[model samples]
Target chain A: MKNFYKIVAVVGLTMTLVPSLLFYFDVIEIGQMKLYMAVGTVLWFSGAIPWLGQKRTQN
Target chain B: MADKSSILKRLDSLYEFDREPVTRNKLQGIGNFLGMYAGEHVAGTEFVIGMLFVAHGVSVRDMFIGGLIGNILAIGSWAFLTAPIAVKVRLSLYWQLKKICGSMLVFIYNIVNALMFCFLAGAMVAVAATAVGIPFGIEMPALSDMLPNSVGWVVTVLGVGTVITAMAILGFDALARFAKVAAPWMFLIFVTAAIAVLPKLGVTPGAGNFWEVARESIWTGVAREGQSQFSFWHVVFFTWLANAAMHLGMSDLTILRYAKKWQYGFSSAVGMFLGHYVAWIASGILYAAANSDAPGVVAYEAIGIAGAICVVIAGWTTANPTLYRAGMALQVASGWSRWKVTLLAGAITTTAAMFPALVMKLLDFVALYGLVLIPMGAVILADFYFIPKLGLQSFYAEKKKIDFNLAAGATWFIMLALALFLNLYFKIELFFLPAPIWILSLGAYLLFSKMYQKNLKLNLT
Candidate 1:
């Protein structure tokens, strides 16, 4: 279950990063890029929050 | 006097193991230090500072190389100056300071430190206000704006400040978790935003003309109207001394005390490179592309709604901790409940946030506050190392039960007076004052301690 969440987090991160690069290179429209970024943001929180504090204190 | 003593005793009891060395069992590994520094340095200030560098006309070559050298110096300061002392003592800065400066002086320092923290959090609130005002089509403050520009601006600042203050008063644990989760993602947005905006500034990714475009349109080496011209030296010194309070002023002694080894100070490099260096450059690119001093507008234009939301979260998360710290500082002096003090701090901060100049003049403000706190750091260094070597007692105030160490107090005031004299009469820029004044302060403390300690010995005899 933890691995599944970790994979989901990584995929979320990739979604956030790849679309920006794609937008930069003109491979995708910025509108699409923004949508992916927003989604990626949600996905990242979903995957990361369960593990954020239980693993270690970041601040 | 009795009341004050009781307050000091209460303050001492508020923290666990605050009055003595941290035990070995509680020491943290390097990974904790790395993550903490990385999460912290990429904050709301990056949005203002990077853009300000462009506004001040730093050339591309100067920006990169100067920032590199400056950040290296900062890392060295943390490692050599702050971390070693923290490891040797294993006590927080305030507790350590109380031993050297005595309770009265530390009380004064607490008040001054709290005011600086409040103003800093106010600046972050202003940054967040800029984004919150966006949906309302509220006019962004121009670079030259020092006052609140519109009713919408005032309302936005008040609204944002209230939320931030409430969060601070409530507790920081939840927000801290949010900050940690957001840090890596926030850093990536900075990178991607710059990349996304490159074409708007006439930089084609594959073209060999990238540098040319960057030079002409981006860094341009031309100051905007009413801004001072900056160069390699400005960038180097400003970046190096940007967090002088934390490193040179010994404030990080509180945090670094938990490190298992002094070498963990090198973990600051992650923050310096990622946030101070790259994030600054990226935000500068966004500013140059958007041609706006409003962090939200530029960020929004670069990456759309995510960019704007990032500005708001960046400001709020950073401000929450700052206001909390301010409350803690005040709680020592005021002897009030944490929530009441936090509310008072929030009021002061929110009032300051109503003005736009705090964020607009953030570079100067950062330098000024750091300069103000650094003399006490010099006193600490001198008392810890040179006092014993000079045959004077270390922690003299504690040994004698003095409530105010005249030598330490004198050192702090004289240093501030000298700094003011140099700035007002000699026209030295504020950014260039900390280094020279720090040296002068160290020498002054040593000389004064020699005199003061001898007199006290004579009196006792």
Candidate 2:
């Protein structure tokens, strides 16, 4: 459970910070910036997989 | 302890004997928290907030910086203040408060909290109705619209409200599941819609001129005619305090109490930055394109069907949890079944949605609602932390078997009055009052409790 939280925190934080950096460094186009953000969001949600799966197992 | 046993027995009965008790599990709890926050944040309100920043004339630097800083503070408040207490108590705010301030006082506070939530959910229903109404050739309300102008609007609002209410009534699991499903997709729509329209607004890709056009054309920090202008401070403060009632006000104690650690609160950044920041910027760009001199519709009109649909969904995503919370508030106050009260609250929200006023005045309404509820949070914080350190008993009402705890009651009222006085007498902005009100309520509770305890000579032990 603790490990799952750490994964969520790391993934969530990285997803949030990475886009801001990419946009700042001019490494991505504005369109691609948004696309990268969307992908990052997917990863953040993916991190929640462990958490959501836990509920099913407990039930 | 006689008082404590009776309340505990009643709470046990309310949950039914067979149900499992809430436990701190990091994964499941974080999943629920992430979904609820992300779904709620990304949906409906994004459209309104995006348009609002544009209306306020927020500079590009201010919008980016202000949004980032403000959301960080909001996330921090949730992580540090709300989550720790939630995990420690492992109880809903309503049940916990009954042990602290007594049933009578909590009853009154719960009613007010529920109504504020209903109205907020109504605003989201209004947003969704606008999108549904588009295909029906239903007239959409303006930025300043207040009243229900037509039957089509009323019917659409009721329809949307019904769906939102049904989802809310299914309880926490459903809410979490729905949020998770919606958060990612809704986020995509926001991004796609914004990107699709950037070129229409005369912004080009991969050119120095594109960034220049973004600054001048897309995020020009200029308000259209008839809209009230917002400054950097207003944008920053509004974003910071938008969920003031939930995070800073400790409302999420109900949700976060299941977390294994306070850090689960940091999961809110997903909702805040992704939904609030990125989505907000996207919607603002869409709104900018929609603005034209001819102006048959507002900036949202230019984005056509797609923009309007996003606005409606955004409203729903945010409003569903708000309405669900309101339903819980009503259940606490009325002692009615949670499902039933939630349904009733849904009806009220739907009715409120028929009138465009709530959505139109969302900025002001959010500030006012936060102001009203924040004092209770301050009282809770003081009673929880300060009373023990000051050598006063916490949960004095439960400890003493009192029906009404005057110390907590007085703090609630006095803090509200002081906040109102600041807004009216000192002519202070509404956004600025929560901090002082929080401090004042804390001090008032401590002083009032000491005096009350002295007079009653209550046996805290």
Candidate with the greatest TM-score versus the true structure: 1
| Candidate 2 residue pairs that clash | B43-B314, B44-B314, B44-B315, B56-B230
Separate DockQ for every predicted complex? 0.57, 0.06
Please give the TM-score that candidate 1 achieves against the real structure: 0.97
Error of 1 at B125 (Å): 0.7
Model 1 clash pairs are none
lDDT of 1 by residue, B1-461 (tens): 23888767756665545777989998998998899899999999999999999999989887899999999999999999899999999999888898999988988898899999999999999999988888999988989999998888889999999999898878677877788888988888899889888878887768877689778977878988999999899999899999999998999999999998889889999999999999999999899999578999898888888889889999998898889889987887778889999999999999999899999999999999989999999888888888999889998889999989999999999999999999999999999999888888899999999999999999999
A18 Cα displacement, candidate 2 (Å): 20
TM-score of each predicted structure versus truth: 0.97, 0.79
Query: What's the true lDDT of residue A24 in model 2?
Result: 43
What tens-digit string does per-residue lDDT give for candidate 2 at B24-95? 443255786787677667767777777667766778877888888889988998998888887777667766
lDDT of 2 at B255: 73
Interface RMSD to the true structure, each candidate:
2.2, 7.9
Query: Who wins the lDDT comparison?
Result: 1
